[model samples]
Target: MKKEEVPQDESCFSDTEMKEVIYAVDKDGKYDKALSSGWETKTIVLDKSLEHIEERKAQAIANIKNGIQSPIAYFMEEHRMDIPTLASYVGIWQWRVKRHLKAKPFQRLSAKTLQRYAEVFEISVSELKHPKF
Candidate 1:
C-alpha cells in the first residue's frame, strides 16, 4: 500500500519495532533504506495474522474443554503445528500423532512417548498430559 494509506493506530508497529528495507535509489544512487518506505503494509498484515492465530487458539481451548479432543490438540494449536508437523518433531508417524490427539490414546501413551512430545513442545510431560489451559 502507499505510505499515505498506512493506518496510524495502536496496532501498528511502533518506530522501534518496525523493520527497514531498501526501497529505492537515493539521488546519489545509494539504496534508500527505511522502514517507512515499503514495510507499512507488512505490519498490518502481521497484525491480522496474529488475530487469526488467537482465533485458532480459542477454538483449540474450546475443543479441549468439550472433550472432543485432547490437550495435545490444544498445544499443537498453541505451537502453530499440525499433526504432520508434530509427528516430525516427535519422531512419530502422522497417524500416531493423530491418535495422540484423542483423549483415550493420549492417556494410553507411555511416559517415553509423552516425553518426546513434551520435548518438542518445550513443556514437562505432566504439563503435556494435563495442561493448565
Candidate 2:
C-alpha cells in the first residue's frame, strides 16, 4: 500500500467499533437497546441500493414542499386541519384566504368576521379559534 493509503492502528476501527459509532457510544460504552439492525444477507431483498433509497426520500420531501407552495398550502398553514375532515370538508383559515387572493390565484370568500368566515369557508368555528398551523 502507498504511504497515505496505509491504515493506522488508532484510525482503523473494527465492526464492534463501527457499531459503537453507529450507536453513538464511546470505546467501552454500551449501545442503546432501542435500535434496529438489518443486514443485506437477511430475508429482506430489494434491487435498489441505500443511495437510491435516500434519493427517493429526498424527492418525496421536495414534492411535499412543492405541494405546500400551492393554494392548498394556504389552508395547511392557516389552521390545524382535522385529518378526518380532509376528504369531507374543504376549507381554509380566515387570514390565509386574503393572502391566497392577493398572491396565489384562489376563490373569493364572503365572510369578514371569524364566525362568518368559518361558515363561508365551510370549516368549523372550533378549528378557526384554535390556532395558526
Candidate 3:
C-alpha cells in the first residue's frame, strides 16, 4: 500500500505517544516505515481482551471474598497468571500453587512462602496475604 494510504485509524493509543510501525510503499515505490496510532479492528480486539481480563479479575475477587478461593487467586488473576505459571515464577510445584489457591491451604502458608508469591507479584508479603481486592 502507498505510504500515504496507510491506515491511521484512531484507537486506544490516541491519547498516548505510542505508534504502530507499518510498512508501506513510498512515493518512489520503495517500502518504508509508517507510523499508525492504531487501526479500528485491532483496537476492538484489544478492548474485548481487556474486558475479559477484567471479568476474570472480578470473579477471582468474588471467589476470594466468598472463601471459595484465596487472596492468591485474586493476585494470580490480577497478574494474568495461571497456576503453573505462578508456580514456575515462585519456584514451587504446580500442585502446591493449586493448593494455595484454596482459602484453607493459603491460610496455612508460611510467611516465607507468602513472600515468594509477593515477590512474583512485585508486592509486599502483607499485600500478598491480604490483597486489597
Clash count of each predicted structure: 0, 0, 0
Per residue, candidate 1 scores C-alpha lDDT tens digits across 16-105 of 576444355555655554344234467579878878888988887888888877898889988988788889898999998898888778
TM-score of each: 0.76, 0.20, 0.87
Candidate 3 weakest lDDT stretch, 10 residues: 124-133
Better of 2 and 3 by lDDT: 3
Q: For model 2, how does the per-residue alpha-carbon lDDT over 67-125 read when each residue is reduced to its tens digit?
A: 43223333433333332343244454545543542322333333353455455446765
Residue 11 in candidate 1, Cα distance off native in Å: 7.4
In candidate 1, where is summed lDDT lowest over 10 consecutive residues? 2-11
What does candidate 1 score on TM? Answer: 0.76
lDDT of 3 by residue, 16-90 (tens): 999989999988999988998788989889989889989999998888899989898888888888778898999
